[model samples]
Target chain A: MNHQKREDLVKSVLFVFSITASLILLLIIIFLFNEAIRLFQEVSFLDFLFGTKWNPEQGLYGAFPFVFFSIMATLGALIIAIPLGVSCAVFLAEIAPGWARDATRPVIELLAGIPSIIYGLFGLVIIVRFIKVSLELATGETILAGSIILAAMILPIIISISQDSIESVPKSFKLGSLAMGATNWQTLRKIILPTALPGIFAGIILGVGRAMGETMAVVLVLGNSENMPEVVKQLLGKEGSSTVMQLINQVPEILFKPGEALTSAILLEMGPAQVGGLHYSALFALGVILFCITFVLSVASNYILSRSQISVR
Target chain B: MINSKTSDKVMKGVFWFSALLIISILFLILGYVFVEGIRVVNLSFISDMPKNNWREGGIYPAIVGTFYLVAVALLFAVPLGVLTAIYLVEFRKEDNLTSIIRISVDSLNAVPSIVFGLFGLSLFFYYLKDFTGGPTIFSGGLTLGFMILPTVIRTAEVALRTVPLSEKLGSYALGATKLQTISRIVIPSSIPGIITGVILGFGRAAGETAPIIFMVALNPTMPEFPYLFSQCNALTTQIYYLTSEAISIERAFGMAFVLISIILISNYSARLINKYLARNIRR
Candidate 1:
């Protein structure tokens, strides 16, 4: 009886620690939104979401171009990463010999373990220099530089998740396809990819979440601007003397401007901006937006995971 | 059938190409860091201090700082995390409170580390200032402790859940109490998994630059014994500073090399422990 009572007490204390941890997450969301909602009162939601100018110094609090840049950089990274990541997963899950899989698995794991700061440094030295010479540009920190580093950083996550899904396809399914006269490659391409589509899609969404939340590394290479990319504007045939056109030209003369994305904007503003200022609140507002987007994406992926018949989770 | 054969060949080529690309990217990153970093990372460089406004000398201080930071983080986090796991696994009643806690933990796991930085800045700097003081090693460690809580709890829970029910039943059958069964059997069995989480979490905390950026201050005066309230420099943040400023490219590379080695060794050790654990379980 005495021992049982002591056990219950110790267990209750442990329970409190665990509950406190979860409570902190709820507190973070409420606090971030609490700070962020201040910005909404200062600037209408439409202007904050769609207005083009982001000269917070001039009290122009538009953040749409930063949003556009973040999306473009993330999409650019995905364009490079998806093919490489998905293919690598397919190879590891279905094609690689056991020895080969063991050898390569550690290498990819090591790649993932390499810190983001190191990647930023590598991009700054070799990639930035390479891009400058190859593209004939004055400076190399651009959307492209950020995208390359991000793609590398996100590749491991994509490969690991995608591979899990591919391997989880029941052995009977593979044998069935082969017995029906399909080749190994045909079975993988026709049956396996389709079956694992939801998992792969989840992996991609998670990768996007990673790329979007990334700050320190992207900040190092992307010049941290609030303007649109010239390459994008040029491709759009955007040449005129209108306000938007002038804004595009105002961006430094380069194929890709040294630009800031949304996260970088927050990082840059967080340090120097005075506490409790509108600028400070706006940065927090940016954090709130990011938190919401990632939260939704994560919850959506969880839904997909639950909905799927296969237990990728 | 002929068309299908041709498509198979094409798809096979694509898969092989992707595997090749991943290997090459790995080699490129490793090779570049090693070649560039090896030139500056001599014994003296590792053992010395930053001299001449950080243009010369070694990175001894940053190494020490990272050790204390990681140690303090583990010291605070490991106990809380392990306790939480024990509660969830051993004492959970499956009621609404328990389910809500589980969901919140899952959602917490999904929150990005940078958001933790923001909250850390606000909580430690703005709100919890009375206890945390301001921008100290303790505050940074606390912030990181929060950041890594989900990792520790989830891994510990997994390790606990893996313990067989028969072992507990056997202990009870022998007249040992529930506490004795847990302390003797369940915990001993779970130690390896908990250690794995600690090491991985340590590696992550050591490498993390975002979470502590605002919560920790720069100690320009050099590394004396770190106090809870004193500032310190870490390997990752120092690399970021050194690279951006280009103050000393060689030192930045050297630091990068060391930081990479720290994480690599941690990962390799985790793999070894996991293998050893797996073999023991089979027996």
Candidate 2:
């Protein structure tokens, strides 16, 4: 073929491919909206949002407890991961010598590359066992186990992004602080931290997204219980035999130890669920919520990063 | 002000504590997996079919399936991802349209795999189910191809962007056309970056379980060959299957170790290749 013809053909082909990629995202939104709307027809939108119950078998299907459980696990992970991650980033950027930087940096990068399934395995086998014995609680599985595992999973993203942000801070500021006889800590706190705030925040937000949307690892550990909030409260206070408590008691201890296995419900139960049933719909709704929150977080991160870039320029 | 001695002590404590935590976590996890998995990672473990005995049998089907699916994804993704990146970087003018494309790529990367799972299951499997007869490698591959396209495009674009503007100018100065300059000069200069991006995609495609799990429920035993449209096994699928069997834990760990090894090898190779090409380009 002539060069002109060839070039046109290639360009058109490439355009079609990229369009397919773009179209897939649109399809996801459309499909989710359709399925989620179907769900709304069955359950009130407000009930799905604010209702505490989530027993699909009984036709009580509120999503508040799962939302709370997800938020707590994610927030708890951030609380543990950020301080450690930021501190490590500080060490890498300002304190590590050149040789150490070269060796240590890749190690941190490797952490990011480890698949989520592997993380799930480690949590399931090792972390869960360790926690089960260490806590000595009736239910070895707790939200705390998921938080700790997720914190480790997100640690690298936080550190790597934060290090880049910290390094990008103008050297002049550090030099000026040093000239004024400020200690390294003083320079880091007064000069580096403030300037790098935007990038650091961007990194933390990305880490949050990772934690929030995490599937396999959280699924493996979070004891998958489907308790309404009021039921949990009532169970907590009275020794009386409520129906919810009786049902929960009938379930295996291993299955419900984490008190509520909210995260893994999608991956674990999807395989066996009767198609077009409430369980399946609920999982799809969960997927929809997870997608929206993570998408918003990523967009916000890019915005912050761009703002920081403009500021630097 | 805190005394120098106290400051030094504090810094040392903080650095050591943080460093130790990170190093310990990495080593502990790796060590645990290796110790448990290595016991069952023999040849029999790799070659045997998914028998009732999960502990002694191999993960042959999963390995085959995983590689097949990834190969299919790359077949579709590499050309398309690289080409779109070239168009966006070279041919298209900086306009609102291009900005939309850029934003879309970023958003694409951020979408969760499960959402991609649902979309892939619906659009490719459900809509196109008639063509393939059912969920097969074609559907799974298309889904993963869409999922990994953003990573490939973004990485390739960055690689293309890193090529000096002067090089483009030099090609134009020699009266070369846009296509010639891109293919001859820019691509050669950016080959490392492009390959690195491909490698990155490979790592992702290999490890993905959620998106494909629902779509590709192939037969467990080895299916007949030349069956492009048939269901198949993969490493992640095997891991999932093994997780359920009471004794499959050891084999699952071994399979996981293999998967992790493959990912690390791909990533390390990418970094190495990128560095090599970059060094040559500068010279």
Candidate 3:
């Protein structure tokens, strides 16, 4: 073929393949919406959002409890993962010896690369068992366990991004602070932390997105309970536990159960989830919620990073 | 001076503490899995068929099945991804069309894996199941191929972009056709980048549990090698199943350890391939 023909053919091929990617995304949204339409038709939007109860058999649909629990667990995970992940990044970028940094970074990256299922398995065998034996819990699955594992899962994302952010702060900031008689800690605390906050937050937001949508790991550990929020309150009192415990208490049990019709529809119902069931639509709805949350978080992070770049300039 | 020293100690402490935390976590996980997984991960474990007794079950089928699925998935994904990247990096100008492609790729990467499974279930299962007669490895692979396409495009594009423009100009000066320049000069230079992207995508595909769970639902008891169309078990699915089994926590840990080790090895191999390509380029 002539050069013009070859270029045109290549362009056409590339365009088609690129369009495949877009078409796949479009297909997912359309399919989910089509299947979930039946769910909306049957259940009131308000009930799905605000009603206190969730029973598929009776056709009651309230997602408030699941949403609340998902938020609490994810927020709790962020609380733990962000600080530790940032500190790890700080150490890797700022203070670690060359040998240590080289040795540790791969291990962390490997940790990041390992599939969440392995984490889920690890959590199930270790964390859940430990929780059951020590805490006298009804079940091994709890919000605390989910949060802890999630914190671990998101740690690498947070650390790597924050390390980049810290590394990007320009050496002059560190040198300038030291030149001004500020100690390393003071410099890090006063200047580095502030300068790096935007990137760090971006990383944290990424991690948050990971935590919120994290399925296999959380599903494996969170015990699949689908209780109402008030019942969760009662469970918290009986558990009589720490702040983490109370938070765990607040997580509705139904969302964690296999058959319950609330949160975690994706992980729980992948195969055996009845066709066109409320469970399936709820899962799609959860996907919509998850997509929106992650999208917002990503936008915020990008905005923050861009603003910080401007400030530094 | 006192304050400076105090802050130094504090910062150092935090750093060390964080490092220690991460290291210990890795150690703990690896240690636990190794301790449990090794007990059942012998020749028998690899050779035996799925038996009612979880204790004596083998994973030969799963290992082979995983490779087959990944290979087929790659066949579907790599060409398209490489082509897309070539266009984006080599030919396409920065316009609305290009920007749209870039944004879509980014969004693809962020879409959760479970969502991919749902998409696969509906598109491949509901719409096209008649073509394949319900779930087959081909359908699952097609779905996963689409799932990993964005990663391939992004990574490959970056890899191709990293090729120096001078090479392209030199090819043109040599009276080489544009196609010749791309195939001979640009791709050769960006071999490392392409390999890196492929490696990363392969790693994710190898370990992905959510996307293929529904697509390849109900693990086959024994894998048919000659019949690649036959349903088979994969390492990810095996790990998921074992974890969920009431009596197989030990097996689950063992499988998890194996999966993690395989991922690490693949990554190292990919890195080695990149280095080798880079070395040859210099020569």
Candidate 4:
């Protein structure tokens, strides 16, 4: 073949290959929804989403407990990870010596590379035991346990991305702040952080998405009990105490109790649920819900990242 | 000025402590696992099969199974990922199609691993059950392949982007077609980046447990050699089962040690390869 024709042929082949990622994504959505919609036929969409009970054996499939716990765990993780991760990023970006920075990078990378299963095992053996003994709970596998593991799991992602963004802030900004009688901390707090806020926000969103979708570590430490926290039930119940102080006092009890997450719900039940059955379809619906949540988060992250890049440039 | 100075010092101390705490977590995990697991990880453990219903013995089958799964995942992912990346970097312009493709790739990366498992179970295990023989290594590997595809494409694209424009222009000036320029100038210069991407993908596939759990069964006995269409075991799944069952804590730690070692070594080697390649390209 002529060179032009050969080039055309190669281009078309690569084009087909290029579209495969999009194609696979399309297929995944279609397949998940196709199976998930079947569950709606058996159970109303609102009932599936908002109903509280999730006993599959008797045909009750309320997913609210799982959704509530997943959100709580993710929020808990964010609270723990954000402050520590941002401070660590600042240290690496502006304060750490070159050798220290170099040494820390590989450690973080190795930490990130450790599998979720290992994290789960570590949590199961160590964190759960520690929490059990310290908190004097019947079981240590609670929302707090899951959140701690998730915070650790997502810390690397937050630190690396936040560090990059912080480092990318224009050197001129820092110099100008310092020249105007600003202390190093003052400049970092006012100038550098605001400049890198979009990127850091994007990283935190990505971490939230990860923590929400995390399965193995969460499943191992969450105890996989499909029940709403007792505090939430009390608050919503008619005769429960309405005092703010009392509610505040119950927060620790809520966190210490065992719960379920969306990802763990699917993982633990996938095996016993017969294929094409309502149980299986309900799980796929959960998958659909997870897909939508992460999809939005991912799109938002990409949008912020792109916007930040343009602004920086 | 005195008050501000004291506050700054306190803040600096906080940052240092945060950094130190993060690093200490890594060391703590490593130290805990190695101390408990190292005693159980002798040559016999590496080579021998699990005996007495996985309560005692080495994880040879799981080790072999992880290798096969990673190998198959790489086979499916590398070519498609690299080629797709080539098209994105070389052929595509800034347009709606490009943006859509980029969004899809990012979205795919963000999709939960368990969701991928569900998709795999639906498509490969049920729809194509006859072809895949239902929950075999083939299905599991393909599931992992899709799971890691975005990582491969994104990394390869960055690598391809790093090849200087001048080198491609010189190839074109020498009467090379686009295909020839890419093959001769672009790919050769960006090989290290592509290799790095592949290595990263391999580590990811090997370490993933959720995507493979439903598609592959835990084979207590050794799988038939080279049986791609049969149920198989993997290190990640084995660790999951062992720990969850609380059968043998020692064996679980040993397997976790093995899995972590593989991932860390691969990540370290990829970094080294990229460093070497970057220096060479500059020269």
Show the lowest summed lDDT stretch of 10 residues, model 2 chain A. Answer: A250-259
Error of 3 at B144 (Å): 1.9
The estimated TM-scores of all candidates read 0.91, 0.91, 0.90, 0.97
Q: What is the lDDT of candidate 3?
A: 0.76
Clashing pairs in model 2, backbone N/Cα/C closer than 3 A: A223-A261, A224-A261, A225-A261, B45-B58, B62-B234, B62-B235, B65-B233, B66-B234
Q: Sort the candidates on TM-score, descending order.
A: 4, 1, 2, 3
Model 3, runs deviating above 4 Å: A1-5, A231-263, A270-273, A299-313, B53-55, B217-219, B223-228
TM-score of 4: 0.97
Ranking by lDDT: 4, 1, 2, 3
Alpha-carbon runs more than 4 Å astray in model 1: A1-3, A229-255, A309-313, B93-99, B219-226, B276-283
A120-168: candidate 4 lDDT, tens digit per residue: 9889889999999998999999999899999999999899889989988
lDDT values of the candidates?
0.80, 0.77, 0.76, 0.90
Q: TM-score of candidate 4 restricted to chain B?
A: 0.95
Give the C-alpha miss distance for residue B229 in model 2, angstroms.
1.8
Rank the models by DockQ, top first: 4, 1, 3, 2
What tens digits encode model 2's per-residue C-alpha lDDT throughout B1-283? Answer: 8896578669757965786688678878778877887887887777778665444567787777788889888888888889889888877778887777777787888777767777676666656678865578777877788789898999999999999999899988999877899889989898999999999999999988777877666346454555567787777766766664445677779998888888988998998988887898767
DockQ for each model: 0.61, 0.54, 0.61, 0.85
